[model samples]
Target chain A: MADRSSKRRTLRLKTPISAEDIADFRLGDVVYLDGLIYTGREGVYKRVVDEGAELPVDPAQVGNVNFHCSPAAAVREDGSYNVGAVTATASFRFAKWLDRWFEISGCKVIIGKGGMTSEAYRKHLVPQGAVYLTTVGYGTGALLGRGIKRVVAAHWLEDLGIAQAMWVFEVENFGPFLVESDLQGNSLFERANAEVAKNLDALYEGLKPPVMSRYGETDDRKDELI
Target chain B: MISTQTLQNVAEELMAKAAIEIPDDYLAGVKGMAETEEGDLSAFVLRAMLENYEAAKEDRRAMCADTGVPRWFVKLGNEARIEGGPVALEAALRRATASATHEIPLRPNRVHPLWRTDHNNNVGLNAPEIDYSFEPEANWIDLTAVHKGGLFGTDYRMLFPGDGIDGIKRFLLDTLIAFGKRGLACQPAIVGIGLGGSKDTCMVLGKQAACLRTVGNRNPDPRIAALEMELKDLGNSIGMGAMGFVGSSMVIDCHIEAGFTHTGGMPMSVHAFCLSSRRATARVHADGGIDYRTDPKWFTPYMRRETVEWQTDPASGARSA
Candidate 1:
């Protein structure tokens, strides 16, 4: 394990990541970030993409990195904020909003849990020159929280509430994310899944099928539920 | 009588402990898995998780940002009495949940399903579900807080008696492989299997088996215990590990809880308590003394009584009513 991990490359890139910076990134490379990143998911996506609500903060001002997350946060009585452990949500569910989101937000990096499919990367992210970095452990929330230097602002707290609100953060060394998808749409998870799938059929060799079967989206074990 | 104040205070502390601390049994299990994990990426993930636990403890913050849907499991001693009745107990639990959500600054994950309303607190309609059980010959209440992730790695099926163990294995593999991909289910988990119950009961038992029981603990029934070991080995044998990488760390432990069911049907459910595996328990004595611990010790002999009457001597295992 150590030998394999030793061979993997690690990098740290600043926010508003450039095409040149991410172009050489390979699937499974470790990455850390420095500068501003904002949180947005279903609520923010619906408000801006579907409901036509203008973004409360300009994308250029906040930088182009978007995190699919909500912080364990609270607002103090003095109208200040207390932001604790920060972790990512599954990014697959937001694939639908990606195209429009990229158009509106100019996001160049997507940090989240469970990287999107390679197809999603090719269609939605490749054109925008964006890449996906997944949080380590599907989290490392407390470590990530320690990386946060300050909460720049939180928008839509009244309307969307804390979980759904858009939060902009100032961060430094803010990740231990793995590069799940690269510029050419190659995905680390898909590669891993393919290798694991090779041994799957043999595991069920003698296990007979159930007497009763229910309707499902797919019966293929190799296929992902996402 | 236990005062509502003590209950509320203990409940609040349990909430924080559940969110911030990785219980010892689970931590030890993961450490063992990490040592043996061969997949490079999987090993890296395990190492990172270990570090994250230390970070959480040092910083006094939640181990996972998605803090999961907070819920309570209360065990009341047959002789235990609260200053107020069940209604007041419920209120105290709710108040503690709300207060801790703000204090621990837990992410308010609960919402009004259709309307999408957020209370900025975990409290809501049927939220923070409190489950109950009773223990004989004691005068204390046990409060266990389980912060289990709400998505992926769970499934239910109605299998016939004829389906047998092979059928159960198939379903387990199916659920594990499906959600185990991309680490969606957060593999290397404590996988719990619920067998021989009605559909809802199957779901509940499976969840309790995962969240309430500690690692290395086995069911009382000898046959069930052996099956648990078999399932645990079978899960780890799947060439999958942390983050769905190819390796042998899919399950750190497996637990099964069974119930008498319909004669013709053997319903089953599978639940995965993920990498975080957040839970903490406290016993509040009638004299208002509180004792905190990691293990829930929920499945007592009396709770799993096979006969119609409570007849077993808890201390001696003798048959007496």
Candidate 2:
């Protein structure tokens, strides 16, 4: 069932999202984060997790939220990264590292598109005080306009290219992010899927099969709900 | 003859438009969905999406970071005359991509697939994947540039002939559900389905349907058109609302196209496009006239499907229930 709340507001947050702050969030809650957030994705994760390289920011000061993104920017002649657009990429491929990312980076919130796939992340999250928030897939422009305030520090523009480098941003009121996975191990997506399965069952409940087997299918597909 | 400069300018303008701005049709669809969305969260998300589009346009900033690798679908007239021909045209497209990277400034998305070396200019071997079609009597060149988003990719499936249309429908629904499970590929998705043909051809048609077709358009084949409508309704009913928030308007549109297939096998491909649906079209005439349009008219050569008629209420802007 859809939440019928007519009024929606953004909850402004400070840096280092505490366990209490994240635990208070329910699945589907909308919030705005204003503080220091570090960005990392496939390339940085590969370097940190697989290659055992040291991250530039110390785990303690990197704050609670870590954005999973490969930002788009034009490298200026002065060597500073200009903010063109910053959008979340899918975080499923890096699912194995979700817990480790929290452990190593001390970030309790992971911001990315297409929520985490690994059930292991859920299990790891509850104890470690973490959650997964989903940015609107097409809200990248809004993210650039309002979410990101400015680029603070950047590493690996030369080594990893503009898209994959680790960019630290000073963000102000940075989200209308949906809490896809909460600290309680609850996922809005899992609930939605359960509903979808029911809807699929109901859709095929009483359909009759066509008289002619248009293609030469040996098996009878009449009324079988896939 | 179309000069090298003309081709380059057309490419640059189209790519820039596609990268930075949300085409008018897609914006209308998003607005319509926002009006009709059943879930509050979905509605909120839809409005946010519209704001994003507006902000990007007003700021002249690239909407989403993944300005995507360019996918060109070019239709050349038989009577078309050019100075350097296809080779020159290809060179112009490549150069435009490089130029646009700095102007609209597209994200350098092209990376060496195996070696992971970044091209930094969005140009590599077969960088801008280009496809061509020829119209024998026409004397113009029509190009549709689709900025294929780098978020997720097209879904493909091949089945034996015996599996039938039912199997195909199930595959599509299942694929959509899976996408929804993985946060629903940016919400209110535009689903493109390809039926029949070989693996690659079906995938191409699906891409065309997703990237080229407009929101309210229908397929020409009656049966296929009916399937399109059914899938659109069914997929929405799944309630994977904006970004997997449970809601009624999960999909904005479903575009399907079919081609002749082999006797032994059936191929069905699905491509899910985010609400952004970035695309732009340009037509260069023999008289040196150039026209730019948001609509690609991919189905211009095909027939219109006559399925069930829908009546809309003007006051409420709602289809008759």
Top candidate, metric lDDT: 1
| Clash list (residue pairs), candidate 2 | A217-B162, B101-B105
- Residue A181 error, candidate 2, Å: 2.9
Q: Report per-candidate DockQ.
A: 0.72, 0.35
The list of candidate 2 runs beyond 4 A from truth reads A1-9, A59-62, A206-226, B150-153, B160-162, B302-321
lDDT of 1 by residue, B75-170 (tens): 999999998898889999999999999999899999899997888889999998999999898999999999999989999988899889998888
For every candidate in turn, the CA RMSD to the true structure comes to 3.1, 6.6
TM-score of each: 0.97, 0.87
Query: What's the residue-level lDDT of B183 in candidate 1?
Result: 93
Model 1: number of backbone collisions: 0
The model with the greatest TM-score is 1
